[model samples]
Target: MGDKANCNCHTGNAVYGLGLIGAAIYFISQATSFIMGVLGFVKALFWPAFLVYEAFSYFAV
Candidate 1:
């Protein structure tokens, strides 16, 4: 029973991460590549940069 909860936590985290990536790709598509979907998806592979920027910007203030 305890193990099941732990497993679900990890699974949920993985799903959340994937969802963020998908969202980033969608936003990029809307901004730059609505015509060529793959370009935005390729760009979204660097989603970590946005996350890092947000973290630094938040703390810098």
Candidate 2:
């Protein structure tokens, strides 16, 4: 009953955790240099923000 209310919180965390891992793998794989790999790791941490920004730019005039 009351416990079910907290389930949604965990679900969001799981989704974000998975997304972060996937993004890290993708960005790091594409990186050719060690510095680029480090940059990719940082970029992976903010992938969602970059996504939203691109989405807004694409949809905006």
Candidate 3:
């Protein structure tokens, strides 16, 4: 099985890790920009929502 078939576990982990990295990048970008006024406001309003999303993604995987 190791030699003949490709394992999907590693790929899934890599994708989940990449998703977290991308989320961090997006959050940082949103935080650093002053022009994204509405987005910033919305983010502030839903910070807990983001946290919940992250928690579920991390734990439910």
Candidate 4:
């Protein structure tokens, strides 16, 4: 039972870490777009990639 509790705690931490990583990626992408202006077209590519990544990550978790 104690081991199960520990495993649950670790899973929670992993989830929290994933959320933070996703948020950081989103903010960084937005910042890059703002800074690059029209050149942000390249950054636009990242949104789809990010979405795919998020979907995979969520399902994998």
Computed on alpha carbons, the lDDT of every model, listed in order, comes to: 0.70, 0.92, 0.65, 0.60
- Lowest summed lDDT over 10 consecutive residues: which window, candidate 4? 37-46
In terms of lDDT, which candidate is strongest? Answer: 2
lDDT (C-alpha) at residue 4 in model 2: 84
Q: If candidate 1 were superposed on the true structure by all CA atoms, what would the RMSD be?
A: 4.4
Tens digit of per-residue lDDT, candidate 1, span 8-54: 44776686589668866686758754645666665566667777899
**lDDT tens digits, residue span 1-61, model 3:** 6856864557866765676566655665767566575566556555657888999999995
Q: What order do you get sorting by lDDT, best first? A: 2, 1, 3, 4
Q: What is the C-alpha RMSD of each candidate to the true structure, in Å?
A: 4.4, 2.1, 8.7, 8.7
Ranked by TM-score, the better of candidates 1 and 2 is 2
- Please provide, for model 4 over 1-61, each residue's C-alpha lDDT reduced to its tens digit, 9 standing for 90 to 100: 7777665347766765676566556566666555554345444435556678899999995
- What TM-score, over all chains together, does every model reach? 0.42, 0.82, 0.41, 0.38
Q: In model 2, what is the error at residue 25, expressed in angstroms?
A: 0.4
Candidate topping TM-score = 2
Superposition TM-score, candidate 1 onto the true structure? 0.42
Off by over 4 Å in 1: 1-17, 28-36
What tens-digit string does per-residue lDDT give for candidate 2 at 1-61? 7898666557777888899999999999999999999999999999989999999999993
Candidate 1 local Cα displacement, residue 21, angstroms: 5.0
